[model samples]
Target: ANTAVKVSIDPAQDGPVINRHIFGQFAEHLGRGVYEGVWVGPDSTIPNTRGIRKDVVGALKALKVPNVRWPGGCFADEYHWRDGIGKPEDRRSRINASWAGRPEPNSFGTHEFFDFIQQIGADAFISANVGSGTVQEAADWLEYLTAQDSSLAKERAANGHPKPYEVAFWGIGNEVWGCGGPFTAEEYVTKLKQFSNFSTNHNKNMPTQQVAVGPDGDGFPEYAEVVMNAWSKRTWAWNIEALSLHRYTRNGWPPNIPATGFNQKQYASVIKETLGMNDFIKTNIAIMDKYDPEKKVGILVDEWGTWYAPTKGTDPGYLEQENSQRDAIIAALNFNIFARHADRVRGANIAQMINVLQAMILTDKEKMVLTPTYHAFRMYVPFQNAVRLKTNYDQGVYKEGDINLPKIDVISARDNQGRIWVAVTNIDPKQSIDVDLSLLGKSIASADGEILKAPTIDAVNSFAKPDVVSPKNLSLKAINGQLKFTIAPQSVSVISVKSQ
Candidate 1:
């Protein structure tokens, strides 16, 4: 048996609130992410609520998704909101130049997006076009969505809904350093100021916070420096509340990593690569702190998750990739990292919610299967809006070739109702780790939750076999004032404790 890892949690210490937005979801027009993966026509045989898939909505509702960033990653830059606002048949058809030159019918537009989120009880985070759109266009779009009684609001009313939609957050652009635009940091900042100045949330009661595009990832620190530096010097009229960052985990791009059917070496490599998220968050937050010392301007990791080679015979532009146990580990590691920095790492949205990279759900016609990443998200739902508890643990090393990862990753938090929760990830693929947990200032009366694990690192849930990677019940007993439990190898376990 391996030596036991010690975990100590101080529930009395004040820590940052794990913002519910950190558990946000992303839906883009790329591939079937917004199409068949989410919106199947109301007339289709699939179970749906007004064109939105009922099963997808039902699944996401269980996770209590706080927000959904929509319209695009790169697609947002080229999208013209006007093209999607009117009658369905009158809506214009355009080619998605950023993604495989596929025909975009504009079927699932602004109205449809809000309807889907409403059904699932999520706030809207709309990404406005900046790469190929003008300031006037963006301002008008905002008015159309939030204005109480403007001409655009009337137009919106004529289209369908009589009430203005509540947009909680607005993203100015996507990856301006790359697909959003090849613009240099300086140029993008200039555009950001202009768009931010005109983009007004007409409904004063439901003010929308504006987010400017920041660096793509650690590869380009200059983007953050330039954007944050510009923000620091900005006047009251042109300020942004947050900056957006986009990063994905993969060995390298051209995405050679296969989503499934991989060796243990590849699994370790992926785990090691994903562990870099903590460093990425720290490095970017450091840059932000240099400019905004008070940390008022939050950092939203709007795009993150594992990206792999497209499934064989699938459209490469669609970014279709299978999800597995390795992806689940990646998700849990990222969640823990975000929680540790909850003060400034305000929110995050996984790359693509469905039928895309690191998706939570995958669909084939009418059949839907939850991915292992989905299970991870479901298990950690208790951490949403929960105050972080200072947790210290000794994580031993798991070595594979030159790759070294902490065998165990753990985080603890106290929810609003005073229930303490601990999320543990056993990164080792070959051995379970026994945890000797000590609640420093609390006595556990009961502990129970769920555990997600698979027999193999590459294990996945196919349409025919949906329960292969599903979560199972986990119960822990406190013996002599210490909570003891063994975490399965390559598994994620979330335990909720009620203390006396």
Candidate 2:
């Protein structure tokens, strides 16, 4: 029997406004993620603007990408900004030790990154190198990007960009407990104070919020406890406005899970694992609330997404994985979770932007194809800055062996333009679920949006067949203030409702 779920949304009981930055992306200097996936140089045959791919910028703009974190996951710790600045031919070269020891040509540097984000109409979230760098180095880098009349600013002008760039968020360091520094929570807090103190914003109009490294999911609550405790006692001289947390959905490290050709058991395991993100957020937030009762600090899940073993023949260090419908569902689930905790959950960036992990766009030289995860991000654009409406639903169970999941997941919000948007995901892989929505304080006249559903759970889009998994138009009419719709199994749908 098909499951019947009832979702009650009260627009009158408006909650926190979901931050648009929650839809941010991360672009690292790893694998083809930056080299071929996003940059191909002006001399290449691919259509590019100042060495940045045009197709990628166009596709990301459609999603209204709020921000992009650059200079990487582990790469930031080893990257020397000075090496990536000057003339391309004169630039220094180093081995990407974090990745597959590939030659780091320093081709795509700071100027190129700002240009790419400008083209996509997104803000910049840069991660500083504290593991292998000094406070002076991090401070100088900021002056170079945000300083107006300083020598670094003149240096920036000598390169190309005469004006200072606006950096929205500055991550102190990434994964300080691991690849970043392997520093103890106490040791890292000391470094955080020194780095945050000197990393000043020269562009007073655009102040950059500092993000301190936090825990690695629920496993290390001590990291959050210590970081927040330190933040709680921080003086006006040195403080952080946000804390960073990193989490990824995967079977295990040295990933044994494959991105394709998985069976029902594997699929169920992945869904069950991905759903744990809710608990991860709740656990960490609880700790934050204890130390900072006023909620002055926000949590940024900077590195997240599905992590499967690299596709066959791909470099293991590259961390490249194929994205499927399963990935799309995971993306929707995380978005819904983020919306529920919008007050403290200010932003999040999927593991990588292109051709890495669960990416939005995959590029092969000149050809590019949008992934299912890309469609999911496009569909959820309506919820970017919308105010969250109080939603209640009786979530039934969908069981596969020992793995149990909620049959249906949902989130509804009222956009700035007064349109009510509802996102629903049917988690069951075999049976479709029926949703009956009752909206309070709003009489729905009609509803329409896009639905992303593929023939199978593992369905994906390839260069040869890009449309294999894409969103299709969906329409529904409300009767007596109640909207009815049937959501296909293992699919995500976003509906825009207009009041009568």
Candidate 3:
């Protein structure tokens, strides 16, 4: 038997409130992500509310999704808001130059998105088109959504609803270093400031939280420095409240990595990349701390998650891929990384929330299936809104090829009900590890939990086998003030213990 890994958690010591927004999701206008997977058209045979799938809505609500970003990633920078408004029939059709070059029908636009968000009880975080749009266009879109009274408000009312949509978060652009625009950080900062100035809060009751397009994962420090430096020198505060960052966990850049049926080497490589996010957050936050010592602006990892080659015959533009138990461990590690840094990591939306890369749910016509990543999210819900608790653990190492990773990853939290929750992932592909639990603040009176695993690491769920990888009840017992349990290899486990 391998030595038991030890874990210690302190409930009395509190840190940042793991903001609900940090558990946010992203739904871009890519492939079936918005069209069939989310909006199935009102007249379709599927049961839907305003063209949004009822099953999809129910699943997202169960996850307690706090927010959903809309419109685009690279697509957002090129999207023209006007084309998606007024009438669905009258709305213009355009080529999605960013993804798969598919013709965008503009059927599910701003109104439809809000309808979906409302049904799911999530907030909207809209990304503006800065690469191919004007400041006036950006400002007018906000006016149309948030203005209580005005000609644009009248135009919005003419479309359908008379009330303005309450929008709190707005992204100035996406990936200013690449698809967003070709401007240097200096030039982009000028544009970001200009765009923020006009994105006014017509609804005084709901103030807007403006987010500037930040650097990509590789472009940090240098890109972040230039923008933060500009903001520091300004005589007044920039409207920007958050700086965005995008990263993807993959074996290589793009189009080479496999989505499923990978060997242990490939899996380890991906795990190595996912684990690197911890350093990414630290270094980026270090730069943000340099300029804004008080952390006035947040670090929004708006685009993140596993990205792999498209499924064999599917359009590469659609970014559709099969998710496996491997992806569940990936999701678990990344979410824990975000929670560990909850203080500055204000919000994150995993890339393409449905029927796309690393999606939570996949839908074919009227049929919907929850992926392992979805179950991982469901299991980790207790981490949301709870205060972070410092956890110290002796981590075992898993090695493959040239990569070596900590065999275990974890995050701990204490909810308002005084229940202590610990989420743990054992990433070792071959061996289950015994864990010795130490609860710091109080003794564990009782413990119960669920574990998500499968017979094989590559095990995945489909419409024919939806329950192939769902969570199962985990057994645990508190022995002499210490709770003990065995974690399966490549599995995600969440344990909630009530302490007196």
- Among the numbered candidates, top lDDT falls to 2
* TM-score of candidate 3 versus the correct structure, residues matched by position: 0.97
Q: Whole-model lDDT for model 2 versus the true structure? A: 0.91
In order, candidate lDDTs are 0.90, 0.91, 0.87
Instruction: Name the lDDT of candidate 3.
Output: 0.87
TM-score (C-alpha, index-matched) for candidate 1: 0.98
Q: Write the per-residue lDDT of candidate 1 for residues 267-326, one digit (tens) a residue.
A: 998888788888888988999999999998998999999999999989999999999999
Expressed as tens digits, the lDDT of each residue in 161-241 for candidate 3 is 798898868999888778878778888888988888878868777677898877776664577888778777765645678
Better of 2 and 3 by TM-score: 2
Residues 343-404 of candidate 2: C-alpha lDDT, one tens digit per residue: 99999999899998889999998999999999999999999999999889987888899988
> Root-mean-square deviation of each candidate, in angstroms?
1.0, 1.0, 1.4
Model 1 residue 147 CA deviation in Å: 0.5
